[model samples]
Target: MPLPLPPLFAAWRQSLRAGYAWKSLRGDLSAGLTVGIIAIPLAMALAIAVGVAPQHGLYTVLVAAPLIALCGGSRFNVSGPTAAFVVILLPITQQFGLGGLLLCTLMAGLILIALGLLRAGRLIEFIPYPVTLGFTAGIGIVIATLQLKDLFGLSLAAQPHNYVEQLSLLLHSLPSLQVGDSLVAVVCLAVLVLWPRWVPRVPGHLAALAVGAGLALLLERAGLPVATLGERFSYHLDGIEYPGIPPFLPSLAWPWQLSGADGQPLQLSFELIRQLLAPAFAIAMLGAIESLLCAVVADGMTGSKHDPNGELIGQGIGNLVAPFFGGITATAAIARSAANVRAGACSPLAAIIHAGVVLIAILYLAPLFSYLPMAALAALLLIVAWNMSEARHVQHTLRIAPRSDVLVLLTCLILTVLFDMVLAVGVGLLLAAGLFIKRMSDLTDTAALPKHFHHALSDLPEHVLVYAIRGPLFFGAAEKALSVLRRLSPGVQVVIVDISAVPLLDMTALAALANVLRDYRAQGVGLVLSGPTAQVRLQLRRAGIQRVDGQLAYVRDLPQARVKALRWAGGSKT
Candidate 1:
């Protein structure tokens, strides 16, 4: 049975005490504070990348981090805005605006909760390794491209949505690049690249942000033409204030009041919702993949087992709640989680503390964020892109993986770049599944033996046939077994199927066996099953094939099967 949803407050209380040791509390607090500092800039930068306000990113960290830590099974997982979600959410927000995007996130959260309730958390493990690599690499490319405009402060005539068009526009705008912005970006990039080597303990990205912000401020005072956060956005709470509550509330939104660019109500048509369903599903799938993958990484570092199902539920609840607060989609942040562990977090309480830190920053430090330059944020994301791409893994996959996997990898990469993440993952999964079925079918085989009579075998009767089954009997291999059974000669008094060598049988294989039995019985042949594995026997019994007349003669060994076959042949004669 599937596990029930855990009580949220109870989980929070449990998390506070989990992994508790007086020796580790001080270290955990230090680590939590360090991670909080690192996550602040990243959370804001990812929010910008997704076309949302920086505060929304802080909202995600505030709500998602603690909620996931409390309800999730992972000891050190910090959930919030991640680079992977940026690839998916940006297009959604671009196409549908923030309202529709919020609805999609809500739907995705519900889907994730359902998956957790259905105990489908382990399903993420089935995603092909190449497919993940391809989309990740493609996402990195997209993120890098998005950063270019900010990196150079290019003033394009228009921003394009597609990657190719975006690049073309960026190229066209190269002449408009501001020298001041370029200098700031270069400095930020340098600090991000070099600070880690020297300060090993301090986060280089945070240092880069500080340096870049200072440079931008200095340049602004010196009368250089560069953009700051204040130029791009203005915060207004009077228009439509979202309900503010603790992070434990379920995410909900009334779609009626949200408006589009035309000042009209947002589209709430069923068709639009239906169209958005695929994207929502894609978001949930990628969330599952990225979150669970991060959790696994945390497990390796912390030497703790994570409940994948519980984590999925927590993610679902976090996402479900976040959209109402004007937050975009979220997932486990691998970089942040690793930092939390390295900082010496002892338990989930450290994650909760990190969330508290972000909330404090959001409420008090909003204006200070206005001084942060877009170029510096871009540089920060550039580092994030580089890390997420895992170029070394990409090269390794190309060298060691099979041609088919490489083909899948390449296809997913191209589709993600040319179209969208939904299409890429869909096509990649289909291709992978098809190749797997083909491989399994290739490994499956069946053969029939002709009837033989031996005088030395006096115990044996005439008109008896024996057929042997080997290898896994699954959907891909069922056809071969059926074909062999169909080829059995007429007038055979007894047909014995020897299945001892068959290691597995799925629903399709069981159905094939039933059809063969029914066909042989109609042809006046006595059918005997022999030497089935324990699992195979249980399956047959469950499928109502345990009895043959008043006798149950399923055998456990070859010798017993041979003797049973002889008796069946003799009984037919009598």
Candidate 2:
């Protein structure tokens, strides 16, 4: 047989083959601009949330967005810096600085590409819904909590690492809250919450930021202090210092050349890569899960199927190339993709155009963005955190889901908040697996033939008995399912085991059956395997179980096996 073709750039090819229409182009254009406007504030906010300059987030949009759009498997997937990474990235940025974070992103890109090549994308579907909800809810709490320092304008001497520490620090800093910043945050958050219902056509992020910036400006005129992006972050070019983001595109440079935690260039070596591997895996895992989940959502909205492996490869390529251009980690943003669908995007071109919009903003609107109040960005992220939490769904699941599922969910949530995502996911999966084994083991059974069957076997010997085995026989269930055979009556001279209903037989089950056969033989009893499926018969033969001299027998039907058993038991056969 010929080898199957690789799943690469399938989205682009399929979109073009569907025949582009002018109406489609118009929809794409509108959707692109609308989502792009939404993305500008979001990209910057997410980067700031990760403890980096806002320009790094814009660079992610400029590089990764177009690359993923052109090569991805979902036509409407919008890729950029996302809020989910805030929990994972912030710690990395604090300990290793921007350089380490970029290196970790690069490593994650390679891992994603490997996963695609290995065709492991379908495995992502097996992750339970409760687990995803748990971690996401936990992350939302973390992100919202992180925003508090800006939201309340609290001054912190140092940032803490864990959620509890961060919360404690925030509470302690409550005395230092700036009234002007708090006022701006409240106004922006209120607009963000109310504007979606008031003017659904306009993006809330844009309106909220505009109003918040205006409020901060008025406060500044009143001789009150409110932190703005320009005052907090700055860029340098041609030996001249400039406040806010630079009005230019990201240029190619090694990630290790960026500033480390000690304010020096990073030393790239095997030890550094090894130290970063764990976080890199975490980033790649989260990225793959988020991006694929986003694609599934897009598919549901548009009634289109996506090539998951192709999507992974696209995301890998985007991340692999983006780091050199000063971009941080990125993935498909669910909110932005949903907005794309609602705005009538029909192909990947809409996402690419969104990248162009970000590029334009970076070159021309950088200075204006510098004037945006940090409090306004905090408000935007607060809304994101609330939405990401999916509070109603969580509550519903807790109320209606199985107790074990609820346990898993809560465990994951607590672990994520107290420790980290990697540990939470690992423990949750193990717990889920153990519970699944118990459930499946309970489903498998070996039961005696019903009393009604005895009516048709009137001539059968009293020394013969029949039992049926059902369900898959694996390690978790094999011994329990076969325990009934071990309790056979002493007077029973022959036994028939019906395994036609069994669908699978693993080694553990085969071993158990072998032990049962050995015990039955020592008791001078005849064993008849009745109506075993072909596959089960193959397993019996491979395990050295076959017809012997009046000791063992295999029959194609249950009636034939009964007749044989009767003869062996010296009973009158029908």
Question: Could you give candidate 2's per-residue lDDT for residues 1-574 as a string of tens digits?
Answer: 9866668888878788777899999999999999999999999999999989999999999999999888778898999999999888998999889999999999999999888888989999999888899999888888889899999889998879988888888889999999999999999999999999999999999999999999999999998899999999999999999999999998899998888888899999899899899999999999999999999999999998888988998899899999999999989999999999999999999999999999999989999998999999999999999999888988999999999999889988899889998899899889889999999998899888854676645556678888888889999999999998889786989888888888888999989988888888788788887878889888888988786555665787888887778878888774
Clash pairs (backbone) in predicted model 1: 251-320, 251-321
Candidate 1, residues 1-574, lDDT tens digits: the string is: 9756553443344445664678678866887788888888888888889887676788788777787777776777888889998878887777777777778888899898888878898888999899999999988888888899989999889758788899899988999999889989999999999999999888898789889889988898898866777677665455843322222322345643465434466868898789789888989999988889998998899776678888888889888888777667888888988998888887777888888788777667767777788899999999899998888999999999999999999999899888888899999999999999988877777655444433323444557667777788899888786578677666677767778778888899888877877776677666777789998888888888876563343667756666666666664422
User: Roughly what TM-score does model 2 have, to 2 decimal places?
Assistant: 0.97
Against the true structure, what is every candidate's RMSD? 4.9, 1.6
Off by over 4 Å in 2: 1-3, 454-456, 548-550
**Stretches of candidate 1 above 4 Å error?**
1-22, 218-224, 236-256, 261-272, 447-467, 482-497, 514-529, 538-556, 563-574
**lDDT (Cα atoms) of all candidates against the true structure:** 0.79, 0.90
Q: How many clashing pairs per prediction, in order?
A: 2, 0
The RMSD (Cα, Å) of candidate 1 is: 4.9
> What's model 2's lDDT at 112?
90
* Model 1 weakest 10-residue run by lDDT: 241-250
